[model samples]
Structure formats: structure tokens, C-alpha cells
Target: MTTTRTADPTAEPGAPSTTTQASLYQQLRAHLAVLRLYDAAEHLPAVLDAAIAEGLSMTAALERLLAVEVDATEARRLAGRLRFACLPTPATLAEFDYDAAPGVDRALIDELATCRYLESATNILLIGPPGTGKTHLAIGLVRSAAEAGYRTYFTTAADLAARCHRAAIEGRWATTMRFYAGPTLLAIDELGYLALPAEAAAAIFQVVSQRYLKTSIVLTSNRGVGAWGEILGDTTVAAAMLDRLLHRSVVLNLDGDSYRLRAHQARNETLRKTTTGTRKPLS
Candidate 1:
């Protein structure tokens, strides 16, 4: 028999023996394991077989294997970010109904969705009446920030104030401030929804000042800036906070009929039509 040297010099081969092939595969798997490429290691056998069947080059095969690992890594990262964000619900700019609020500037919203404002540490103020979709827009923007690999947090203004108040009482005020200030984009929803605790204005001001020119904020409020003093219970504190927030900010005023009310009216109309039809005899 004419002997031929296989790729592995010590292999007893005309073609590589099954034992040698298995040994090499095990070594590859071990190396991947050591590198913490668990996803790639798990998919190795199938990927390698497909690569061979397709006659792929070594570099191409490696690329294909690494792509799987990359995808899995991204999925894990996004899930972690979303969990940390504590977003009440999933909302995206694409899911918003611009037609429902004619006063909303669709072009401006599209621009904001690109997330360029975050890069400059700009604030976004969503001012509107109740049920005008301010919270929806704020959530959507924060989701975009999170998707863009920025650390994000979501909380209602009332909840944030209460937490800060409690933290102060527990003597963990500094830690609480750091937690709120840490996110690249901090979204405070439902500002002015309910009366905040006493000293809440000072707490909120500290959070805003801490992040001023350092990170971005997206706040949704039912009351306009003029009424913020009443909401925060201190005109002076509100002014100071607004000074920092508005210095580099995007203020979006969403003016329109309440989406919830519109939906309710629509349902009532449908019911009325159905009831009237039911009263008539079926010919």
C-alpha cells in the first residue's frame, strides 16, 4: 500500500483515520471552550459538516462559526439591557400612531429616533395633556437608546421621587443618586400624574443636575413647564432643574385628542350600530 502523510503528521493514514479525526475535533472543541465560545462549540459539529459539504475555505468556515457566537452574544446582551431598563411595556417609534395626533411633528420624531441627541447628552421633554401618548413616545425613545447599546432606565416621576425619599431616610441617598445617574438614558414617565412627596422636588433636581451635560433624560409630563412649579412644589427648584434640562434639550409638545377617549368613543359607536341592527328583524 502506498502511504500518504495526512495533515496530522503522526496520524496513521492514507486518509486520516477516524480516531485522528475525532481527536482533532475534540481538541478544537476544547480550544473553543477555553475561549468561552460556548455557542460556537455547541454548533461546531453541524457548522463544520456544512462547511465541508459546501467546500468552504478555512477562513470562510471560521467566519461562519464566529457569526453564530456573535448573534447569541448580542441576544444575551439585549435581554440583559431590557431587564435592567425596567420598561413598563415594549414600545417603538414604528409602533406609534402619528396620524392619531396631528399636532405631533412626525419628521422631528423620526430624527429623534435616530438617537443623535443622546450622543450630545440632550434632554427630551414630552409635554402634553393626559392620554396624548407622551409616555408612549418617551418609552419608544428610551427603547431606541437601549437598542443602540446605551444603558437605560425607566421609572415614573412619582416612583422615582418616592424611592429617593426612602433612600434619604435610609441614609443611602448617595447610592440612590448614583443608580439614577448611571444610565446613559434615564426616562421618567408620568411627571405631574400625582402629587409627589415633600422634598421630592429637591431630590428630582439633584438627579437632573447630576446628569446635566453628562447623560440624556426623557421626561413625559401632563403639565407644561409653566405648571412644573406647582407639580414639584417649589418654583425655585423647578426653575433650576428646568435651566439644566432645557439648556440642551428637545421639547416635543404632543397636542391632540386623548387616544383612550377616542378608542372608547369608537367602541361605543360600534356598539350602538350593532344594537340598532339587532333591534331590526332579520329578513
Candidate 2:
């Protein structure tokens, strides 16, 4: 047995007709579908109910409906941007442990999050010892840029060099350069970690030179600038690459005990305490 309820007396004029609420809701959804406003259609019922219950005017109701759709569309766009970013992980600045790396300046990181540097194609260099959270900070910055609607990409320095070499071997040097240069922000992680090929230095230098003053770059390295000549096995190439990278860059140096080592020590301590607590006094 269907029970009929009266319409809201305070509902805005030109609201749905005196038909059953369910039928009117379905009809409105169908109309929205025909107009290709799927996001708005999905939220119509709630917005309509709220409007009627709150005695909102027609304009306010329409605005509320459109607002939700806009929000949903923006969310979808952000997701797409992140997916295209090719990030290694979904690390955000909020997840970074500031206390663990006291050398890092939180204020500087916060400023970078504003993404104003992207307009002028500034660079970010995360320099520190291994396990000093350089990669984490780079990932965080890349994620921030992605959220800010910048096209971003992430790759390790070694991987980038290899890809560049492979692209050259395949006779797609220009295409590879374009691919690396296409993103508004490119993150190169773990630079100078492993010994790269002899040609790797030039390959990397080309990439840096091509993107110079045209797009932003965020790179993490365990080695200092002075040591890059040895790491890349080419002093001249390394210096040229550094010139372009440092011209418009913010260098963040991280210093702290390795996070992995700290965790390992904590686990060992916990095990020792547990063993001691369970042991009986020796006879």
C-alpha cells in the first residue's frame, strides 16, 4: 500500500508538479541524463530534497546542484592527472615525518607546495645521504604538483638514462626527448645511487638541457654536486647538467639517521626486552 505525502508547501515556485515524489525524481534524472549531466543527475535527488526542506529559492537549488557536479568533475580530473603522473607511490607532504629529518626546512617545503615555481620552470633538488628521505620528499612534491593540475612524471635517474639510451638506439631520440620534456614537472629519483653507463651522463645532460627553463624538475640524489662527476663518469657532462639544473633551483639537503636502520634497531630492542622478560633467573 503506497502512502501519498503532500509536497513541501515552502518549496520554490516552478518546482516539480503534484505527481508522486519518486516519479518526479525519476523524470528529473532522465532529463538530466538527456542533457548529459551525469554527475549532476546522480546528485539531483539529494539537492532537490535539501532545497525543498530548507525552503531554498530556485536559483539556490540550481546552484547547489551544479556545485556538486563541479566538485565531482574536479575530483575525477585530479585522479586522471595523478594516474598519468606515473608516480612510484602516492606519497603526500602530510605523510612526511619532519621530526625524522630535522635538517629539512618545513617552511621551504610548504612554499614549494604552492606550485608558483612551475610558472617560471624552477627546479628542486633533494640532496642527502641514503635513507635520508630524499625520495620521499621528491615524491611528495611530485604528488603536490599533480594535484595542482600540472602534468607530471617520475623516474629514477638510472632508469631515465637507460630509457634515453634505448630510445637513441631505436632511432627515436627526438621522440624520447619530447616525451621527457612534455611533463610540466618531472621527478628523477635516486640520482647517483648506482654507477650509470659511460654514455648515461650525456643522455641525462641532454634531458636537463632540453627542459631547461621550459618545465620544472624535482630530483633526489644521495651524492653531492661535486661527486656527480665521478658518479656519472664524466666531469664535463655533469658540470653542464648541473649548470642548467642549478640555474633556477631550490636545493634541499636532508640529514638524519637512516629510517630503516632506526626501525631495525627498535625491533631488535623490542625483541631483547621480550626475551629478557620471559627468561627465568639462571641457576
Candidate 3:
């Protein structure tokens, strides 16, 4: 007697059986969805192809997939932080014109860029005349801090003072103060641009007191320390705030003509020489 074999019921006539393969794909998608690995799930096929083509081990393939997901997640997080920071512009140390601002200490600025001062809650005070790149330096350092994974904030002294005053009136001063102090690095620019009233002066002092020794600060001012009392309109408050800030601060006084003015003059001279083949006499 001859025995005859029967075909599998799950197999098709001209196609390989794919029940196990389909089941695995479904299970993978479900797990990835549950774990919120959308990016990895979307790129799974391509990455798998690459891995297989490269003869990667199972462990190596997993690492490659996870690395892509991790990188995407970190990029999104950094973008969110930068948006929340509200930096005037995206400034970096590389874009800074070190040659134009000779007064600034390149070595010190570079060291600060490493974000070591933040570990110790040290303050940085950029004192300079108008257009001497104080604001640029402050923004650069704050950007650096943010890139280094530190929470950072940027606000002008006038704006901060106004916010604090409003919060006080609304009985939300504590909450607002906490928000300002929460950042790892808070950069307050144009400190002496507008003279503060007594209430604003007090508000400024409260913020400084709250964050003193707790977080780092990068302050840019066009006024000297002695003039702060008059600018803030409260001698005692100014003294106290300065005492706290200056105690552990790195002070840099930028002494030079305004960078903006110099740039403007250079442009004008170029234009004059171009228009009429003669140099314009300086006043």
C-alpha cells in the first residue's frame, strides 16, 4: 500500500506560509505603540533592512534602533526648552566677534561656556557701555547653559520688574517669584536701561534674594555698582541685592566704543568712498 501526504491548510498554492511573520509584526507594532516608540516603529522596516544587510547581531540591531529613538526624543526636548527660553536671538560663542570686543576675556568666557560656574551657582556680571556686546555675551552664555541641559531663562530688568509688580498686585507674587527662580540660569539684560521706582526696586531685590546661592544669574548692566542705588531708587535694597549677587560673582567690565556705532561708521565710510572716490573726513 502507498501512503500520500496532504498539504498544510494554512499554506497558499504559490506563496510561502507567513502566519508566524504576520503575528510577529502585529505584536511588535502593539508593543511599540504601548511604549510610545512611534519613531522607532515608523522606521522599523528600513532600520531592520539595514541591520540585516549589514549582518548585525540581534543586540547591535536593538542598540541602533534605540539610539535613533533616543536621539529624536532629545532633539525634540531641546527645541522645546529653547522655545520656552525666549532668547532674543539664537547666539553662540562662535558667532561672537572676540576681536571687536577686546575688553572681554576670551579665556574666561570659554571657561564659562563649559558651564562649570553653574555647578556652583556663581553669578556673571557683564558691565559695559551701550553697544559693547554685553547683551550678546549674556545671551551666548545662557544659550550655552540651555544646550548643556540646564533650565534657562532670559528677561530684561524692566520686564522682570514689571512682571513682579503685577504679580504682587494680583497676590501671585510667590508663584511668579518661584517661576523666575526655578531656572538653572536666569539672564537679566539691560539692568540700567530704565530707572526703577521704589516698588520695582523692592521687587527686584526679592527675586535676587530668592535665587541667591540657589541658581546662577547672568546680568548685563551699563551702570557701575555705585550707581545702582540711584538707578533702583532704593539705596538699602540695592546694597542688599548687590551683596548677595557680588559675593560669588565674576565681574567683567567691557571698556570700548560701542560695537554698533563702530559698525555703523564703517558702513557709512564705505558708502561714502564708493559713491564719491574720496574718504569722508571724521568730525
Return the TM-score for each candidate structure: 0.91, 0.89, 0.89
Say which candidate scores most in lDDT: 1
In model 3, how large is the Cα lDDT of residue 108?
Answer: 94
**Candidate 3, 54-83: lDDT as tens digits:** 998989888888888998898888888788
Lowest lDDT block of 10, candidate 1: 9-18
Full candidate order by lDDT, most accurate first: 1, 2, 3
Q: lDDT tens digits, residues 64-89, model 1?
A: 99999999999899889999999898
Full-model lDDT, candidate 1: 0.90
Error of 1 at 142 (Å): 0.8
Q: Which stretches of candidate 3 lie over 4 Å from their true place?
A: 1-19, 277-283
Clashes of each: 0, 0, 0
Backbone clash pairs for candidate 1 read none
